[model samples]
Target: MEKITSNQNSRVKDWKRMQTKKGRVKSGQYVIEGWHIVDEAIRHRQTIKELMVVDESYLGALPVDDTTQVFIITPEIAKHISSTETPQGVFAVLDTQDYHEKIPDELQGAWLLLDNIQDPGNIGTMVRTADAAGLDGIVFGKGSADIYNPKVVRSMQGSQFHMKLFTGDILDWMAAFQNAGIKTYGTELNDQAVSYDTVKPTSQFALVMGNEGNGVDPEILEKTDQNLYIPMKGEAESLNVAVATGILLFKFVK
Candidate 1:
């Protein structure tokens, strides 16, 4: 393994760049910090390119093969590349999964479609919830938060490795679902929308969650076969997008 002590090192600079979306896109890679997420990446067979740790002690008994580069980085360097307030001193660089050019020949099972949901924490929570609910996949629609964002990844708590994730236009996915004879449900509170519990649960369907503030796009809602609204008995005006997603996903799964 190689040792890197300087924060100015070119490789160190490259890892730091991965904290941004542009850098991730440019290099086709992203950095994940914390031992649990790194271990999840390893166990899930993600294409890991490099692993960096502040101490050699972290190297023993790792499942990585010889091809993955290992580095001993100083704690200072770990902090420089870390997205958290307290650096974990462990990091992994992984190649981003490119699903843009490939669409599955058949769309099956339940899917969650995110329409312009921008909160990293919400996105992450929804993803984790989807995984827990045993959804087949999630489509990150246009205007949604970047899946590889550091904050989003951390919030996901490694659940991303457990399910399929895609990126594309929301309308296109709706069209595809229509072609596949799968019903797409949009969340909204306007007239013509029904209580979420009124719909029968099924193995194959898509649920669309919208922006935190504005809700689903009007055009997208119009395209969905049905629009659903959670009936709240309390005084709360609205539910957090992520919280609403969990309730709906579990309901649909049941």
Candidate 2:
């Protein structure tokens, strides 16, 4: 292990470069700060380019393990590598999972799909909920938030490692699921839509959610086998996407 005292170290610069979307895009890597996230990513056998820490104090804070390429730096240098306000004194540059690993073959066995959902927090929360409910995977529509975005990564609290994710066209995904005999359901606030609990799901299936204000797109609804709705018997006309997901996920499991 090599310790670096200079804040201008090239490794620090490279680590800091991963902060932006373009850098992540160009380098095919993302920054994961905090000992826990680093530990979890490593535990999941995620490729780690560098395990960075401020000093041995950070090394002492976290349990030592089979971490390769450990690098030490000054507190300011560590802060330079992280976007968070309070630097956790540790960070790592992790390789992004490829398209195949992100999208599983059996992605529909309790699926949660996002349809042009914009908010990263909402998307991340739904992924967390889907993981907790023992769902198989999550599929993000073409216009939905990026699952690999840093904000989403933080909000999910490491659910990213536990659950499978797909970030492609929902219609294409629906076709694949349908061809494989998996039923697909989408949420709608229309008169003709069936109440969510009316039909018992018998096999692998997809549960789709839509945009915050617009709801599921009609084109997507046309492709779905069932249109389901969450009955809002109270004064509130609608629910936040994450809250709605939590409620619906409970129903899906119950």
Candidate 3:
């Protein structure tokens, strides 16, 4: 393995750039820290561009193949590349294209559609919950938190590797799902909305979750086959978006 001791090294500088959305797009790769996500990447045989470790201590714990390029970095270099306050001392540069998948011509099984959700933690939890509920995929629309964001990746706990993820216009995807005869449901608290429990659970459907502050976009809600709301019995004005998503998503599972 090669050793990277200086933060000024060209490779280290480039890897650090992946901490931002623009940098990730420019390089066509993103960095995932810690061992759990790396294990998922290795288990799924995703195209990992590089594996960086602070020392040899983690090598035995990692599932690295002959094709993986391994690097040993000083603690300073590891801190420089990491986004978290306490660095994991290990990271991986994974090709973003490896996570891309073509949207199916027809919507099958359960799908979660996120609309402009700005919170990275919320997005990650929704993905994790969807995966746990055995949902089919998640469509991250424009304005939503970047799926490759480090915080989002950490919160997702590698559940993303278990489901299909797509990025694009949410409205277009909704139209496609509707055309495929799958019901499109949006979560919103409004007079016209019905309790989420009122709707019968089906094997195939698309659930639209909106921004944390504004709820679903009015226009997108209009496009939904039906707008549903969770019956909150508490004094709180509203539930956290991630919490609401979990409550509603599991209710959809057969």
TM-score of every model?
Answer: 0.96, 0.87, 0.96
lDDT score, candidate 1, position 40: 88
Off by over 4 Å in 1: none
Please give, for residues 1-254, the per-residue lDDT of candidate 1 as tens digits. 99999999999999999999999999999999898898888888887799999999988745788899999999899889999989888899988888554557898899999999999999999999999999999999889889999988998988878888899988989998999999999999978999999988789999999999999999999999999999989999999999999999988985
* Ranked by lDDT, top first: 1, 3, 2
lDDT of model 3, residue 230: 88
User: Residue 238: error of model 1 in Å?
Assistant: 0.7
For model 3, give the 10-residue run with minimal summed lDDT.
Answer: 97-106
Q: Identify the runs in model 3 with alpha carbons over 4 angstroms from their true place.
A: 98-102
Model 3 pairs whose backbones collide: none
Better of 1 and 2 by lDDT: 1
Candidate 3 is scored at a TM of 0.96
| Residue pairs with backbone overlap in model 1 | none
Clashes of each: 0, 0, 0
TM-score of 1: 0.96
lDDT of 3 by residue, 11-33 (tens): 99999899898899899998999
